[model samples]
Target chain A: MPVPAHHPVDILRFNTCGSVDDGKSTLIGRLLYDSKNLMEDQIEALERSADITGGGQINLANLTDGLRAEREQGITIDVAYRYFATPKRKFIVADTPGHVQYTRNMVTGASISNLSVVLVDARQGVIEQSRRHTCIASLLRIPHLAIAVNKMDLVDWSEERFIEIRDQFEEFLPRLDMKDVKFIPLSALTGDNVVEPSSKTPWFTGPTLLGHLESVHIGSDWNLNGFRLPVQWVNRPNNPTDPRLHDFRGFSGQIAGGIVKAGQKVMVLPSGLISRVKEIWTYDGPVPEAFCPQSITLLLEDDIDVSRGDMIIGPDNLPGQSTELHAKVCWMHQRPLQRGRKYFLKHTTQTVQAVVTEIEDRINVSTFEPEPDAPELALNDIGEIRLKTAKPLIFDGYAINRLTGSFILIEQGTHATVAAGMLFPPTEAVKPEYTDFSI
Target chain B: MNSYHLDHLQYLETDAIHVMREVAAEFERPAILFSGGKDSICLLRLAEKAFRPSDIPMPLLNIETGHEFPELIGFRDRRAKELGAKLIVRTVEDVLARGLATAAPGEVSRNRLQIPALLGAIEEFRFDCCVGGARRDEEKARAKERFFSFRDSFGQWDPKNQRPEIWNLYNARLNAGENMRVFPLSNWTEVDVWEYVRKEKLEVPGIYFSHERECFRRGGQWLPIPPPHAGAGQPDPYAGARPKPAEKHAKLVVRVRTIADMISTGMIESRADSVDDIIAEIAAARVTERGTRADDKSSEAAMEDRKKAGYF
Candidate 1:
């Protein structure tokens, strides 16, 4: 077959998570191998490793276990990113470890993923680890989910066994806010339903796993409602020789939400100053309009006192601005997170001093229950906390816009990043009663 | 479908540009580690796009191993001149002469010698951040690396103790004597690089295309044959002076998949002469780009060990 010609296609980012014995690594290896993404040299290297393979069988798990310790221990240590492409779409797969101790790593992987693939062993259906991964995926507000009922061959490829496992997931999936879910029965080791339709499952008429991945509707992934631009830098080319750029000044940043057009009215936060966009400058010169995720330089009509760490928004759907923030945090440090601990909160383009004022509760991953008033959050712990920052943070709920709602905390003395957080909806919108309030 | 949509290439370009601008804004002193390779060629274009109609805020830094191809060196100088950016050239020979780094006896390749030269340049210039062209798709250990990789005072990497990078919001804080090695191309692949090259109409070194050269077969690899001698009493720049006894010499038409030191860089037999052909060839080729580099083939963890010791 001839290689597909290069054509424009959208990208899809997803992650795979499961228990240690559910064959997550093998499933990923099978996907890449069957897709013809693995090069011959890589395959040769895998086959040449005698110490890791036995009985003349190539252990597919060796492909994603990148670290020496991980290989020696026969487990994945951290998240490893793998890339492959079909003619329909390009895929970036974040292969995460399944160890319960590495829940923080899974969270890190899921934070940027659009879809989450939760692997399940058909022999042991719907275990605690499977539920925990699915719950976390739902909590991260991932738009899509796939429950791969792996090792179906171990159960003789029985339709009854597949339906039984799907029923187990259905009991708890409705409680979660997941909208799109797919279930597939396949054997990762035998290469059954991952890429090709298996003859064993004559009753299974749905698309194969690869077909589902390729045809998933991901066009409405990004938030395109409220315009938000956090000023990253002040582009000032104080050129004396060039006549066109003698006094050029613009605000440079990537659009976090919504669309921005030239001559549109915008409001700068904290100052309540409104201005019209004079020109939108991109890499290919001035453009008439741009949308979410496009990096551009905007020239405002007025010489407003806007600088880095400030936000520019459109005239409608104003984001909430408050000093007290309620957020869900995934603690990643050895030091237990407690009240009265100060950290530097980095949100959007600004970093401000923030202190943990209240520890509300912790979410038990195994049972998916809330433990109220947890004393402290330990490593790889997910909990809700209230914080008070030195300055007001303009943001939306994470469910609305993941870009403007996420943050990370840096410890005061050690300067280590200790937590990843998603903000709740602000209680008030910086005094909405006043039409033109300035702080 | 709505009209507001960005293709994969556009998305990658936007992300890369944002990273470059972030480095410019956050770091006190920064530089671009330019190697004049295909990846670095993309880096320079992104830098231009990030801060254009004005001079680039950071200077270009190159650690010449003294065994580099002359064609690449010429192209590097000419490109920097065209952009009007300052190019800082530091040589491994200078590092050896200053007693800053020592090479093993009869060591012909300077692959290991580049570490000290790079660290020395970072210290001498007080560069807080250095933008690199490393991509995660290059190696296994690199696949686990962060976009803003932190380095200690001695420039060592502890893969197990890395910071938790959540999203595009990167943590760039550092203490004294500490710095960062930022990769804007962490998510791109080899095919993406070639396709972007074709789309942008950028010029690369001629060594990338197929050419006729005197070569030999050694250790199952096709290597270019070194010249007879140094004219006008200049020292020999190539690593190998003579072929081994078992080496079979021949004249072959080949192209380099990756550009490293001339001695360690291997050539593959190909008839591709254009960017489109190269992309198509890569799509159907069996061997990986890094499979041709002799330095990475020393062991399974060679790239990991070198990266841990602060080698770019």
Candidate 2:
């Protein structure tokens, strides 16, 4: 219906996270600088303010630290986003701070990313914050994990040190469920192997960090199995002049998972009514098919009563519909989450009133242990909790479909998003008795 | 039929449509902040994709500072009519006349004064969400704004306490007076906007391209020379809605990169007469898109100061 540009480079949303001194901001600054994405005014601003924030040289970190206080303190207080591109792929980097108190920021920034770059100083090795960032990325289910062992030059470009840090990650990575992991040695400050190949690393034979990032196989990252479309709204353009707008009723939503064909049979959730997909309409025209993550309007064969917050799914692979939800949550508000507190629960297109029923266990990030008897979860605390909703929610486990599986909790009066929750089955954690269990 | 991948523009279009639909479904009453600028023009096209077949589900909202270019105003009214949507205008002159807002002494720019008029309009209409075309790459302060930025009852933005927007789930729940400033173009940059415009063959105002205008130089930028002779000392050229200055104006070859209020917007001497020419000029231009904005050049944190007072 309009002009169309046919460049198919997928946009990769990723984030760079590490400790305060681990050069997370510097890495982002380097990525933007090396790509020459900084406009003249921004560069001039940097040069003008160099004397104030930097110790002589132009501080690349000054580009990302937006607030005055952040510039004054020489730290990142909030999650900042930066975008750059290569011919192979367009990139969006969420530069999240690594403060222990701001784990909520990390969780939120990493939630929508396809990959995560966890930086560690070569001299300091893997610290608590390193494990914390890795664990958060794993919990967020980022498909690809890139552990950048930065400051290789500071360690005389030692392969042994890089392998040692990689070994530490190998021991800790098994506990999480990340499929693709890459270990790269570089220096975020000295520009070694970051965007260019360093001459000192003759022993190393891998692509530069930018090259690897541009070539990562992320096409299969999205789940394309079960068809799930949470109906966002109804498109009824009752335009009298245009025939297409005459009695044009369509179910509109972004496809959360799987593939949908024009004539496929589908079921409306919460109400077990079945119907066939009459047509799939895109802005371009009526396409024969559409896939996951594309926004489109659907015309059903039958005029069933479907509205916002309703679910449209395939009959073969059904999701669990329940009023009670057991979830792993990352608390964000200063007011600790407690039992009997009613909050607004938002999942995909649906929002309902839900209350905390029980606190199963608070996860200690450093030790990877569960404090099962904790009374309440404080800010930035990750815990397993039980929630009871006033209405049934159709959702898959977070392990299957991230879009349908995750939800957020909003404070009732303030409307601030207090926690991010991932849904799972409320199964008993009782270990069955096993005598002489062998592998 | 199996083309699963979308170009960057198509993906951005899909994203904007999703956000628009979400606002329409979640908020009780929503309005789109239309400035008749290129970004807002893209927003209008996105609305068409989102809820068309029917009239746009929301009204077009604009805060007039009484200092807009005549071409911009003409384009704004015509586009609104063409789309069959109600156009709501809140003027700063009316607010000043009613003594609802006061300007600092010698404050020639009415950019800050428009905030109160806009907030007044939101309150009078009881709008829950006001969608805007603000992008993150415009300035440093705007870079931190989320897609669903929350505002207090006073219509003030607390950059420190913004809600974390994860995935596409926007929290649009608001109290009676507290509204949300939704930015669907948060991820789009200036280059992306131009590419989309060229791709969609969207019609923009004549001022964006090379045009002839009578103007004077101020702060190294071309300002439309106020109609007749201003006899020294009596030069409040933008004072009131005086009859469209009608004196024979010595016109110059100038074009503006942004279609803001005429007094605050700057013009450049260029021969870029077509969309392709404009795109090529932008590709080679060294200055940032907002570098020529007189209002933003007033202070380093000018945008931040205005946004705290609910400036879209």
Candidate 3:
């Protein structure tokens, strides 16, 4: 009867990135403040905090920099996530630190974000940190990018100043593969054009930051071209009271791509066995259809031992399954990522023993160029590398789907996530499943 | 196709389910840290959705401070039985009895002792991952936590050195002595929880809704002092403060915002009779749900310190 209900409004996951002094936190604080999302106690805590600035004004950055060290040091060292919703959309903002040295944390925040907001101070137009953050957003393949040229109030809301920053971003925007990029000029300190359009800036006309955030076109962000469901668990309740729960064996996973219907032809990866969906089940009840991002338990018509780590996909467009993978990785550890280092590679629900076969090259974040002859990737280094796994991984190119394309490296000894990787298009792009002429 | 969209609450439910499944697939021994709160109640429904035809892969664990509400304990047992899941409980009193945890001389709340009781349970049961219901929006320290948060061999969390969790690929690898605290509700907010509860028609304790109760004001919060509070030495927070009874008429209709211990839960004087009313109140309330929490009131770094010592 519940029908695995669907909401009218879409949910958007985005992140805010800027240099240390670029007012990234202030911008976020203003968004929360203007949206009435901040709680009174949180504001009271802010007012009571001793970390107020010289000018005082209830230091809005205190809303995010909640850690004691960050508050004392006046710099955000890690990624902090904030949530707020309007009538139009629900938003999850991963406010990542923009100290170029902490780029690894930026990558972590960007991996799951659908959009990225890169703030730039109007005084220092398009600095190296801005370029680095924009490059990182592009590298992570976040679908949307919003460039907020902040401190417009300080510059007297000059249209020339706003256009100068916009042109600077436009110069570098072509080199990257950003599809949807929007530029908004505003002052985070004065709350000029963050939530509501400011009357002061009559020369420049653009949606306010919050307005753009609420109306962004993110429906196409998910991969609808192909179907992918990486099985995370096997749901077998086997309840004695109810016959349905008693023997209902459902393969559970979040649909990573496309739509799945009750009778669609699907194939389980690694096994290569085809099956038809018997029923799509949710906690509320069975649904006729399910799609990408919906975690559902499936009752296959002919179950041939499907479990966690296996993938259920639309047989028409199957993902590649290879023991060896060429991937672009962002090294996140102190010890340099070099060839022949064995680590635990976690891709989706699967974890396998993987050894770095080769370190190809590193990408320079500032210029967006690849550097050859890199012996090893140091901490926070973005590099392309090859890996050989103990088992085959079912995945797509990161450009296709972030859920299936992304993975993280866990150092075998310390068990720390050492790298975030995106699958590089292999030389042999046509996968084994596609080689079959017989449909 | 129905345009392939889930409501925000449903999306959160799906995300939490995926986290649970990942933990189930990866961890050697995993458990859900149940506190009988709304978050954990949502988690029970998720755990059921995750592994319904079979038994839940892990047991439900609770680190009791020995001062929890009787209603919570009863609801916990009943719900655990309803789901046919194992409920493993370890009390701070037991830890104190065994001399593993010592209380500060005048400490009334055993909130700090909960860390040891929890870590001791992990060590005793060899649980590699304990799924908690902590949301990022709850507190500042919690905002920086990963869905699969790592705890080192010392049973401590180093907030500075957290692993870079990218996307849905959670690194659940751990050493023999180490364990991971998985938060399935990391992305869920308070409003989403209430919406999901109302949609699923899930059962929570009666305390969540409006109820008449005898309460007292301590540090500007209405705390429901249970019957055993009359002769407590250092176990009652009001021992030194001498918590005053709100003028007899002050025994107004109130509801528990968060289900902490009877000593720590800050009651909101409300007439929220239903889930919709609760949602409306939460939307309009100026104070955060955790702001009413007595345990996190000490200082700005209380949650961080408690987390470092491995408190859920």
Candidate 4:
């Protein structure tokens, strides 16, 4: 086969979240329009819909507010994804709703985003909605954040006002534990500082919002500390036609963390069984080594008992294995999450019955404070809770590796996913009692 | 080698492959919803890479509208035969024959009938999951769908009540009589499809390329002029929709951007014969891919309505 002529470009997945009045949709519309991502037909559609706005200007929000109710109400109700690619990179933007009642949607969008853009209306500076979104991004451990101080024209493109808004975020951003934060002032409606730098912001020396998004170094976003592979399936071709695959039994999964190579020694969790990697097989072919996020099939030297839900890891770094888990979750269902309610906790490849042992406290999003002894976690509520699982869950803290650190709650009988959770780091690491098998 | 980075195509490929493998390992009986369109052609290629060196684990399922382009049907059969994968075709004619669905008089497109045809196949085979080639960028409502979209026993989609998909983890749990529609191409766009098709060197039907055909204009879209004696047997589903001699038909070189029933699918005039040319044309094109799809043009939420009613 001929090599693909197109050069491989890495993908960047990010999300935008803020209040309805923050002009989040307009900013996204400007980004797409100014970036030349909008097709001619789409622009025509915008013009046709422009008649409805009465201002003779296209309603940019119509691009994202797709649902009938959302468009009718002039607000985003659910998360909608938009894709656009430049020569340098491809972007997958999760345009999430800004309503305070839609915290679940934001958390769902934030789960896989490498970066997050929290828009702040320049007129309002940093408000409760800004803090709440920033708090969610921090809690989700999104590697990068861009605080787009939008509507700069309304604030006279004042450098002083921009700094004031930046200061407001700086005060709470520290408490939020954000590592990479970039603040840019822009006017979405006027198309200033979105794709190209605006002349109005001569005082601002930073790159435009699109420039930052395109140039941000996201290579180190993945947790590459220890080898973690939650085996999703066991690949056994058992093909009678080919002699090489007759007895093929390989553990298959996407490498969640770190790297693995042929002949590397590894341990299978929950079983404590040690084995050496016999081969690493990708769709292209076998390779010497593979890193995080590559889905590959591995053949082991020993035929150990490993199945779905079982995690395989390198012996160097041990993960916490326990029946009790403490996690912060954003409740999604109408039924409030209270003490002693049993639900299905799906973490990685495993799903187990878990019960809420205690609702530690609800974090008041506005104040960034943990209100202790909260009765229940109502819909859109973010709170820390304790749980006991039917089986021991093998995981790392959410701060360490998002793949191994996060889980979801599925309500029993209904099977509706009710919460998105981030697991707290293990209070104590599991002892390497099974190391004897390595010898 | 020091920098572990995947090309955009490679990332999407792996992501899709992961979802395919999940369906293989999770569902009891799974099948791919192949339509022989460009998107599904790319989907078939992804399936090849996903389970290759071994036969595809599942069968290829298609819901024929009985108004399909003959070239596409031919490609579908040949591709399935080449892959050594079983091809299951359930047609709208079968649904009509069984009196399960009725067609309106003068209805040119049997698109609505496809819902019953597809659901029947799922029931007949007891398929717990049907993998499709639907992409989010194709329509507005599609952009809000999860990778693993859940369907009730009636095959209805509830956009509001969807499972929260986190990371690469998917919730494939479903109740009895219920099935799941998993979209591996949920993140891919029309341009990506063409690009991947070029890179993979996958073969599609001839209709995707520009060709000369007799056509007429309606609703600002060029539609092929069907032969007077088309589907000459049993009842013409499009009986009253046939044009009279007074109406003008012209010969034009056109290609379909989005393939549906010939009666409903609109063709854009083009000379883009190769995938490379097609990509360049798309780059300069003014409209969305679905802008030519008459089925989606009926209402602002037509796609959403059909999807909720179990249309793929």
Candidate 5:
């Protein structure tokens, strides 16, 4: 197997949501098919299971329906992941169910996704399910939004219908904290403006779905201004035969931001001891420099002490070091997240004991407003909370670097991951101390 | 030095490496489950990268079915030697001798018998975490798996009550008699595994490629001929004695679609003899990789049911 030389270094994770009949599966199937990513055996399997739909023609939904029950029910029971790659980029699509009951699945998909594509049937045009998905996307703070106006062919490619839905979304978009939102009116079923330009929608001049994905400026998406590498392993090849590697010691991790090259001065978080990059090793071979998201083993020039769970940082651009954290979290477990509950706080490679100090407020999804003084966060509820960790963690705001700024709450007894949290700026940002202040 | 913020791929990679390191750090005795398959092979590569410079910190564990393709076993032994990692081989036959697993009088496949052997090995070694190469996209039950999947004292996976994985945060907290099944490639798909293997130029078993072999037809599939019992009642025996007059069998030329045990594995007629051909074959495939696994063909929730019972 020849690995494509140009691996898409920048990954764009996106989730799709819509009502049962909104053609979400068809759209994903079309995107994958148009991209030439489907294999022959997959097609054969689809043909084999085509009888489940009874329409005789292949049900595009089957492409994502991996479970037998799902195939029988013709519904996406759980989140099914689909992958496709183009010459320019690779996509990991999370095809989540659109039903209200499966909102947790949608959140699970959207949590890591950079973009959210909320499909709406042109005939129905922004129904309650559409609102719910958009709200979830907004709550999750997905940076990009593509309001795919599907089934345009059924509307005879009417511009009025497209504009009506676009306007409807615009009214709700202002209330959300989305940084980038684009509305594309096209049909996902007939392959209109999904992979290629559609002749029917000549009036729409924007790029097709594929074009937008390829051209989207993801370079600035990472918080490169700050460097954060949560140490995953301590590389020590204690092998005497490999003399060169015998003395070789490095804190191995993927560079989470900013340019990291050989000979650059770096520091370990909390310790603040400076060191230099000895060598950067990737699966391909050694490279002079590496950037965000590329998995590479780094050999430090100096043997400054380091271990797993320790963070390596740029000497000058350091993250906030704190033991108390304020964050917005989405509770995922059936047990509500409450104050004084002890749970495991997993941040990066480190897992430490933590307790919820307080639940500040809960956001009402329908109105996009926060309810102050919320007592507890139930499953699928997004709320602001404070936590006290057993040890100090070096981190940036979740808005800055998602990798270093997020943490999960695990139930003490069950070891269940109960909540997903994005950290806000530390409360102790400013402080002063003086011995003679009393005098 | 150029400073680039971490992207999704880097995040996923770091996360996986971190998980591997955690398994090494937390478990007093940890071993990677190596099946000589592509996913496990990629895991071997990751394990190398995780604790490299130093030898892989843990041993490579293989539960031999005594029915695997010869090429796969040979490749498994060779790769373990090449990597300089300790290989621990546990067999179903041993378990049967110890009365841990029982076999049906005429049945050939010991796939179900693997669970007890694996659990026995875990207890024998007292391994806290068993790093596997299972990916979420392989099956429905897998899709619901967490990065740190918890197994109770009985080694059962509760899919409905799985731990929440937020960001790259993984909870590896376990109590006495509990174990963790960590999948570093939980987010990776089958294509991703192949692409990574191809990209890394990683070595895999020869059976992955198309090859000519003597086979017999059963249930609309071609079963390999090594296991003489597989041809027991058939009329035509390609190599051994012919069956009774009433029985039916045909000597056919075929190639393996996906390699499994000799008795249960199925073959697809293909001229794809090279890596590129396989990639092309997979790219155009609609049926999943597990479609050829006879064990999964039993039911839609077959994989899930098995996984809940601690089948890797």
Candidate 6:
């Protein structure tokens, strides 16, 4: 079939995780290869490389397992991104390493992913790394989970083998809070039930990987229930040459949530005064309405006051504004996250001085349980912690809105990203103390 | 065309536009690093989309190494005029005349010298932000870069000290004299850029497409013959000396790849001559675009090392 001009397939951002030699790379490679997304040069290079296995054909795994060390050792060491497009959707595949040492890299890749593809070798069933990845995925609140029982051909493509793995995953699913979970049994190497249905697995009936990706309900993936647009910059051309731009004021940002339309009442956070959306501006042109995650310029009916680092939101359903916050953080730095350690808390467009107030507990990945009274969080550790910001921040629970509810902890001295955090339920509900404070 | 998904292209487009706006709003003086490559072409298109009906809001800066393809230079000039934006050309030859950059004895490539030329231009313009089309997926060191990457006063990028970018919140704040290298297409892949160009119907240099050229094998890859003014002491500069008599001659055939400088960039043997052919070729190929870059073949971290010294 010839390539189409306008295939408006849905978007799918997914991460892959599995134990070493569990065929994670093979799964992604098969998806891209079988889908005919691998470029001609890429295929030729793969074929020419000495790393080609016994079949004398190109190693699909080499497409994603990029690092020289990883290639030499036959493992993934860092997060590699792969892109492919089908008629139904466009996919950004985050091929994360599965080694126990590279867990931090996996967390980084999985943080932004909407779906987590957990590959389980049919023989191994469920391993520690598989559980660890699923826990991390659940902790990150990925809405969808697909347990790909790979190497089915190795296990004789037996339906019993697939069921055995599925049953094991089911026992652990109730322990975590995943909204939608699916199980697919297929051999990524042989291209069974990936983009196409497998006649071999007639005993087990389910949608193909491609079918699931295309038909999945992703419109509800974004948090459209709450209105949040953190102002990245205040657009005031103030150029007299273009009189139209003279006194043309607009706050530009990607909407974090909710529907924003012309004439909708909105409030600028930190300064509680209310205003109306005069227009929603985009690169193409002005639109009557805009929604979450769409980068846009909003012209206010009344230019009462606004600037970068401020957030514009619906006055009725405003985010929780407080200086203290309790959140689940995935510590990413080698340096431990200790109480009283000062870091920059970057939430939306605002960065403010912040300190770790307390470490409630660190969740053990292997067992998917929390260990109480952990003093500090080391690298690749997930924990619930309380933080005190130098200034107030307006945010919602991460479950409700991924954009507004997420933040990063920047090391004060080096400015490195130390942790990825998801705001939990506020520990204290306190009213905003109105005061004129400037940085 | 029927299987094209707009969401992926649209997402990449939106992300690039957002980064452009951030550079405009955050920096005092900004410029787009126009290399006349596919990536930079995509960046120029994104900039047009970002602030159209009002110029690009910044100048298009090209640090000419004097080793660029002639076709590329012509395309760059014409495209700049088409967009009605200022095109600022800085040359290493000028830096050489001023003694700011000096080539080593018997050196053929001025790529190493480009660092000084680029830094000199940044200082001359007092630009706080320089928008580029670098993608993180291109290299390992780039994988650690933020959308709004910070550079020291000397224009050095310390990958280990990059700011954490979370949930699209970019921290563009920097001290005076320090500049930021903004990569709006940091998230885009090579295929994504081509698909975008096809989708947007963007015009790029003809050299990008498959074309017949006088080329020979050198350092395990193909290199184009230097232009007449390229100072020839080097016979078969396209092909390094080999044992076979037939290998001494240059091969005139269509080439697929055109990554960086014509002198250093290797060409892949190909029959695909159009965008559709190139796309089909790419869809079936396993080799990366960087596979043909002779400079990168020098070492594993050649791109990273250059990047640290402020070679954008």
DockQ in order: 0.66, 0.44, 0.60, 0.52, 0.39, 0.30
lDDT tens per residue, model 2, B1-312? 135666677778888889999999999899999989999999999998887565789999999887777778999999999998999999998999899999887787788998899999999999989999998878778877888989888999887777878777788888888989999998887768888898889999998989887776666666765345355786564654122344233468888887678777778878888787777777667788888788888766788778988888
Higher-TM-score candidate of 1 and 3:
1
lDDT values, one for every candidate: 0.88, 0.83, 0.85, 0.87, 0.76, 0.78
* lDDT tens digits, residue span B6-82, model 5: 43445555667767877886677888999888888989988876776678899999998777777888998999999
**CA deviation > 4 Å runs, candidate 3:** A1-7, A50-56, A236-248, A426-439, B228-249
Model 6 lDDT per residue over A197-308, tens place: 8888889778988778777776667766657888976766534477787777778877788877788877788787677888887666898888766778888888688877
Preferred candidate (lDDT higher): 2 or 4: 4
Instruction: Please provide, for model 3 over B1-312, each residue's C-alpha lDDT reduced to its tens digit, 9 standing for 90 to 100.
Output: 246666677778788888888888888999999888899998988888877667788999998887777888999999999988899999998999899978898787888988889889998999989999899989999999999899888778888888888888888777788889999999888888888888889898999989998777777788785665565455553454335444332576999888778778889989888887888888788899998998899988999999998888
Best by DockQ: 1
Q: What are the per-residue Cα lDDT tens digits for candidate 6 across B30-118?
A: 99999788889999888877765456789999998777888889888989999888999999889988998787866667788899999
Pairs with backbone N, CA or C atoms under 3 Å apart (clashes), candidate 3: A7-B7, A40-B286, A236-B52, A236-B53, A236-B54, A237-B52, A237-B53, A237-B54, A238-B53
Tens-digit lDDT string for candidate 1 (A121-142): 9999999889888988887888
Ranking by DockQ: 1, 3, 4, 2, 5, 6
TM-score of each: 0.97, 0.92, 0.94, 0.96, 0.87, 0.85
Instruction: Give the C-alpha miss distance for residue B14 in model 1, angstroms.
Output: 0.8
Q: Pick the candidate with the highest TM-score.
A: 1
**What are the RMSD figures for all models against the true structure?**
2.1, 5.6, 3.2, 2.4, 4.9, 5.1
- Fnat, one value per model: 0.62, 0.52, 0.83, 0.53, 0.49, 0.29
lDDT of 5 at A145: 87
What class would a CAPRI assessor give candidate 4's docking?
A: medium
What number of backbone clashes does candidate 1 have, counting pairs of residues 3 or more apart or in separate chains?
0
Looking at model 1 chain B, report the run of 10 residues with the lowest lDDT sum. Answer: B233-242
Top lDDT: which candidate number?
Answer: 1
Chain A only TM-scores, each candidate in turn: 0.95, 0.93, 0.92, 0.96, 0.88, 0.93
lDDT (Cα, tens digit) per residue for candidate 4, span A29-61: 888998888877777767877876636778888
- Clashes in model 1: which pairs? none
Clashing pairs in 2: A237-B53, A237-B54, A238-B54, B215-B225
